[model samples]
Target: MRALTPALAVFALAAVASCSGAPDEDIPRRICGTKISPEITRPLIGRTGAFNEYSRLDNKSAQTAPCDLLLDEKPVMSFRFAWSSDQVDPMKYADAESTDSVSNLIEPRRTRDRYKSVVGDDGAMATVACEKAGESHFTLTMKLPDATKPDTQLRGDIEKFMTAYMNATVKEFGCRSR
Candidate 1:
């Protein structure tokens, strides 16, 4: 029994030693590094849903990964980084909406926030041009909530919020404005 006791002790020690440096369980949920903060989203969208990562398919059959902030299970806001190789011109987006009803009404104009409300759509949109890490024309869009009856003052307020939100994103991501 004494001889067996030494073997058992060795076995116990070996078992513990083998498992001591075992890898930890993999955690699946990771926050998308888009710098969408609660301070910017809560006032506009009430409470934000979980951080989501998704890919958008561009016209050239390429994918652009974006960090999304969802509200009521819909992605009302998103941020993405891209290179100039994609040949995406953020300013040209306004031209595409020229046929919309609101396009004739308000005309998609560039202000501090670059907001363009769709004539017949439910919400407003803003796009900011960013230069990320020396790559020019990197852009991000802040999709504001839909206003049932958006007046001039309400649109002004939305633009202010969108500008502040874009500024916060710029500061957080260390990107220069283009």
Candidate 2:
């Protein structure tokens, strides 16, 4: 038994190391018809389980579009894009809908002047001016139903992820607001 101890230890260490590495295979490179960076989205979606994406964006000119990310068949994140005739306050919207599990919405200081955005532990929201399709602005709201990260770290990641997602969605849907 003593002779096999070292071999067992090595096996255990290898297994742990492999498990701790990045979960590239589990995360999708694209979501909701938009290509995404796995590194930017991993913290929100986690590193395990089967992943799937469902999107309701058939109408490019539609006022609202929704997408969902699932882990092991359970919803992990949800995204909604809405075009409104008037500007919507992201902070107020997030605050009214926030639950006990989520932190208060905070405006990101680094956000560009073109966008109004808020970040929280469980979600993020951003709105950009848009004139196309008769919409005054485009709003993107993301909800992380299964997020487990701390407030500070999660908010940072949410900002980055939300920015990328919102930009990509606008371009892909040809709603650049010319």
Candidate 3:
């Protein structure tokens, strides 16, 4: 039965490998037609699920745009971009809205002077002065309704991802302060 033992071992290994849940390769590299680095997005997307993006971004003249990332047909993350007549502080907005899920809202230290942003355990928000856009200020927000990371790490990742997303959207939409 020595030969049979080797064959069974091989079959067992194959079964285990197939069962191991690896990250989904089909996760989108872009959201709302704005390209983003996959490295920054993968952590929040989780491993092993079909991903779908639902977006309604009016790049031409809309004052507001919204996007959602769904995993296995369930909403996992939501993003919104809106134009405002005045600068919006993310912390104050969170407070006014009484968002209980958004704890630990801290402004990121690396952002430029014109950009005001805050990252929390479950979300991130930012506003930038953009005189050339439809409004005087552009606001971007990301909400993780179903995040699964530790608070500190999730906040850091959310900050990084939000920064990248905000930059990409601003450039794509041709938002200019000048």
Candidate 4:
């Protein structure tokens, strides 16, 4: 069996450490900010309607949100890498692109041609996937709760979180598809 490397281990540690909260409060943050679709859930639930973090790995009853402000909750990171050449599911790609019911909790506004991002009353992020295929690779990024604006630094955290999940997906290719 191949052995572990020190550099690989340190990188893992750093990724987990930054997963929660902004590195610094002053820096702009892009959390699964209260993207709660207003249509579903009780209205006037308060701007601080309180958010919950459920594990993509497992479901649990619930608990106090790790962050008091909804903007502080880190979205569960996930990705789909199109790598296999022979036979892959077109429906799978289609589902994410044309028919993903990530959450039917909100009405969609015309955001762009590629996809419509339906923001819930709480501001949780989901996507109507658009595939820009590369020769042998395409990446699907679920950047839930992305910061609303284009603060360049905020995008860094987005890339960091996405890269970590994508790399994990590439490594754990045998796990069940979501």
Candidate 5:
């Protein structure tokens, strides 16, 4: 009983420090030397839902940017930052959306189906997925264009533009039940 008290106190202290209600910059980063820039990440970075108004802590799980636009003062559809982990290979991801599930994304793009993805300009790999909830979400992944190589090993394509090409492929995620 006596040893348990000390352990409990230490745990309590850790929770308090982490939950201090400070801004993201003030809080320690998540992992993988990952940093957050508030200028790029506003209230909700990758949220796509009907927004009559905006508020802080509205969509913490998703990534988003603020907008003062001609269309509306709403969150711009975008993606959370890429995740880098030693345990897991550094892989890009779209922030989980309120309307989307894994099943939807991996399915075919049929009228009966409820998912779609779009890869835009090469600078960054971007995907916009929509679901039956009438909510459309977006996910942008960092581009590592210099990683893929042509099939020909001896061919000059790999030698010429290997380092300059982006390895992070923004290929259309086709429907495949794996």
Candidate 6:
């Protein structure tokens, strides 16, 4: 009846407004400790190793696990993503402490930590770290392929690869992308 019509209309309008857009509550939220899916690591494998060679350090029991990439059945690179309320903020840590004095000429501006490099007679190693939503932080460490230390070009490529991978992983995992 006409008396009930007005009340129904108000309720219907409120319902529609509530669901109109993807409010913050509707957006996917990643818990700080959600497990990294295989889909995330798949693209980063590249030619370094077969996807089958990947393994979680804790047997995937924990949401965030250290992982390794193996090539020719040898460990090529190892990385992990961890977020903790008690842990120092990665951005602040980078600013305060100089973990590695290696120059950060090729480091991406968006990253919270400067790219660190170590080149030795054996090979080269690089580390990239970033934070998301001021809550989730990730670090990726890679062992460069060549036996000799990587030159400038190799270093640049490593920076690019790690930056791309970090961005993609953040976006894929429902975190704020850099």
Per TM-score, the best of the predicted structures is: 2
Order of all candidates by lDDT, from best down to worst?
2, 3, 1, 6, 4, 5
lDDT tens digits by residue: candidate 5, 1-178: 9999999999999898555433445322211112334323222222223333222222223323321111034423212332121111111221223143321211112111121222212112233331212223433333212213222321222212211112121122121211
Which lDDT tens digits does candidate 4 get at residues 55-168? 322112111123222323634322222332233333233333346443222222222222222222212222322222212222233433333433333433433333333334
Better of 2 and 3 by lDDT: 2
Worst 10 residues of 3 by lDDT: 101-110
lDDT of 3 at 94: 50
Q: Clashing pairs in model 1? A: 102-119
Best-fitting candidate, measured by lDDT?
2
| Counted clashes in each candidate structure | 1, 0, 0, 13, 15, 0
Which lDDT tens digits does candidate 2 get at residues 54-154? 88866457568788887788788888878888888776677744453222444323355357977767788888877667777888778887767677767
Lowest lDDT block of 10, candidate 2: 100-109
Model 4, residue 64: distance off in Å is 28
Model 1 deviation from native, Cα RMSD in Å: 15.7
lDDT for model 1, please: 0.43
Q: Local error of candidate 6 at 130, Å?
A: 8.8
- Write down the TM-score for model 6: 0.41
Off by more than 4 A, model 1 = 1-40, 46-63, 78-82, 85-91, 95-107, 113-134, 176-178
Ten-residue stretch with the least lDDT total in model 6: 26-35
Q: Return the TM-score for candidate 5, rounded to 2 decimals.
A: 0.18
Error of 5 at 146 (Å): 3.3
Q: Give the poorly placed runs of model 2, Cα more than 4 Å off.
A: 1-22, 97-114
After superposition on all C-alphas, the RMSD of every candidate to the true structure, in Å, is 15.7, 4.3, 4.8, 16.9, 18.5, 16.9
For model 5, the stretches where C-alpha displacement exceeds 4 angstroms are 1-59, 65-126, 130-135, 151-178
lDDT, candidate 3, at 123:
76
Q: Which regions in candidate 3 have their CA more than 4 angstroms from the true location?
A: 1-24, 96-114
